[model samples]
Target: MKKDNKCVDINVSANVGECAYSRGSTPIADEGDAVIRVPVELAVLNIRTNLAAKIKFPEPVLEIKDIKKRVQIVQCKLLLPGVAAGTDPFVEGSYHLFIKGYVRKNIQYASPCYNSGVCVNSEMRSLTTDVPFECVVEIAEDDFDRTPQLPFQNARAEFDFFRQQDLGHGYPEKDHFLSSDLSQFHQDSSQFYNQMPYCELISSRITEWDEALDRKPFHNSANWQEGTFETISEKMFLQFTVKVLQNQQVRVTAL
Candidate 1:
């Protein structure tokens, strides 16, 4: 069967954390209990990878074939519960989110040499992985609605790749995708506990109550929709040990 040119499979992962803030903009004078809710929208803005070290080679290793590297972002999402208050007149609670990362790579061979002594050649190719996420920020109350500022709203999640296995050895020098980092892979997979149902907020207001005047749940969800972020903080070394051949003959001995 011929391969489908329009189909691609993607994997997703999650990250969760606990965050809380005090209820209301100011302290109250009445001893009676009251509740104030703050609403906000959450979304995944970007994904990034940091290479630990550059792939090194001797100046004469000109024909660097079977050279490949890969990176990607498989999943990104957020889950936060609505804030509520009781007798003590305070809001104390936490929430969690998910952010998964992945990588894909390809191999390329240097062109044949014609007339020249041994020389050094370096090549660099760039690629990116992007994931979109959306969620509602709901806070119900007696009157008025406020959208709280999202903490770490545009912060980047860092992924480590130093201990990853080499993807170049298993198969013949060729092109394919590999989930190279397993430890971190599982770490991201185990983040979601989902105690509360994720209410996909209606794109528009659902109630016409007077307090609902400013209840645009995800009015700005598209603000960061086109943004991309870095996931790995450092670059990993992608070294290759190659031999320079000349005249279809071995010019230097193998290491």
Candidate 2:
């Protein structure tokens, strides 16, 4: 090492061609811990479900121009509120996942004109509404990336005492005996907690149909005028896949 920065070069003869490869044992380090704590993937679920709804219009809608729809997922969960922790409940030999969400619908339509029957004279109106929904799907014997991990608890230990009294006259001749306590016995049962399972949404798909069942043309009006609809019915076929997850410990190893 030099304090003052300076460059020095040494002259030597070297070969420029490629060197032959050599075989040797790969180096391996001793592991300090056997397992690592991390979020692990549990199972993948492909769910298919449908929902139907009938909605009423705010005002008189003469004709429908356009409608735009989008899905907004509110929550995805694997655990229910009343279910016990660290336990998975089965219904009909299957696990159930509950999904909650809403669909944002934007309706662009023309309102009927009382004084004029012509569609061009009618006023165009826009309505935005959210249709909420909830559904449950059953999952049984599903495929997993690996064996799903179960909840773990620590080893519990308790201490007890025995009744001890020394008999000086009896102990001088022979060994003294002690008796165990028999009045009360207790073993603590609430020494550990569980890591609950969770859910992650992968993707969602929807096929929807919106129809105006009561749409009718104005009285004594030509075909150019728009029809009115006071009520609308919608059918949505939703499809999505989710991943159930939990915290797990995996062993560290090298191939």
Tens-digit lDDT track for model 1 on 95-174? 34343433333424333223222332344333333223222222233211211222211223456564523457665555
Best candidate (score: lDDT): 2
Per candidate, the number of residue pairs that clash is 23, 1
lDDT of 1 at 32: 30
Candidate 1, which segments miss by more than 4 Å at Cα?
1-41, 47-49, 53-71, 77-96, 111-255
TM-scores, each model vs. reference: 0.21, 0.59
lDDT to native, each model: 0.29, 0.66
- Cα lDDT tens digits, model 2, 1-255, are 658663543234444677888774211122444556667776788877777888788878877888888777787766423333344322223445677888788889877556454433668888898888888765564455534433344444555678865667745645555876666564655433555767777887889888877877667556545567788899989777788886655556644
Candidate number with greatest TM-score = 2
